[model samples]
Target: MKYCLSFLLVSLFTSCKYFDVEKTTSEAILKEELKTFNWNDVDTYPSFSICDSLISKSEKKECFQNNLSSHILKFLQDEVIVVTQDIHDTINLQFKVSEKGDLTLLEAKVDSLTVKEIPNIYELINNSLNTLPTIYAAIKHDQYVKTEFELPMVIKVE
Candidate 1:
């Protein structure tokens, strides 16, 4: 009976050590992954040709936004044909850039009044996106990643 008790105690202690080793190994692996994981933020913002020369993160963002707005404005001015009295409206443009560096329009929300005033707004927006130049995809964790952008476009007719 004493020998059996000793064996049971030794086996329990040995099994505990095995579990401890496994636990330590798992914790170490988790810690190592945490060190490399980036929480919901990208290493680099999406780039535009005009912004590619910029080295500062904030400047790159600003340049990208400015150029995007300019591109949309130019398309609206040059391609879209609208007839309306003095009116102002805003459209929210939501789009995604693919990992393959292609742009896709997710949504374009223009008010009913604007739609009535400019009947072809939807077609115009689609055409604008189709004509837009190729865009660079965003970089996250040193890899190209798909990213979405929501831009508010305000149009004023005088």
Candidate 2:
């Protein structure tokens, strides 16, 4: 009986290596995850339903840009933009995509001359952005994240 009890005890405590000496805390796990993540880049860019079919990152980005540009152009096509002289300028449009997949127009960099030529240019651009379809927020470290984008539009009128 003594030998059997000793054997059982020895077997129960056989390997100390199998026991975890240090418990893993949430802080440690969070730090380890942060170390593996790249803060400067997102895992996935904001996308539209039409662009979601794309697989490659470059293809997804191109699809997003093309869809955005075409939507704005289509909206503009319905309106009439008249200029007295040839106006050549680039409008820098800044946008923000929220983690919840909401698109907001942050700013529209239009020159004084362009504003003068097209008084309601800002309004037109803002309206077009507001009318855009649902956008999926960007992804980083397996979590939804907000992203900023700047798209330059060239205006050339004869």
Among all candidates shown, the one with the greatest lDDT = 2
Please give each candidate's TM-score.
0.75, 0.78
Candidate 2 residue spans exceeding 4 A from truth: 1-24
lDDT of 1 by residue, 46-154 (tens): 7778777889888987777777777877787885465667658888989888998888789999988888888888787777777766678889867899888888888
Off by over 4 Å in 1: 1-39
Kindly list the per-residue Cα lDDT of model 2 for residues 58-150, writing each as its tens digit. 898888878887888688767888888778888888988999999888998989998998899888887888889999999987899999998
What is the TM-score (0 to 1) of candidate 1?
0.75
Find the candidate with the highest TM-score and give its number: 2
Clashing pairs for predicted structure model 1, backbone only: none
Candidate 1, residue 136: Cα displacement in angstroms equals 1.0
User: Candidate 2: TM-score?
Assistant: 0.78
| Predictions: Cα RMSD each | 5.5, 4.7
Counted clashes in each candidate structure: 0, 0
lDDT of 1 at 31: 94
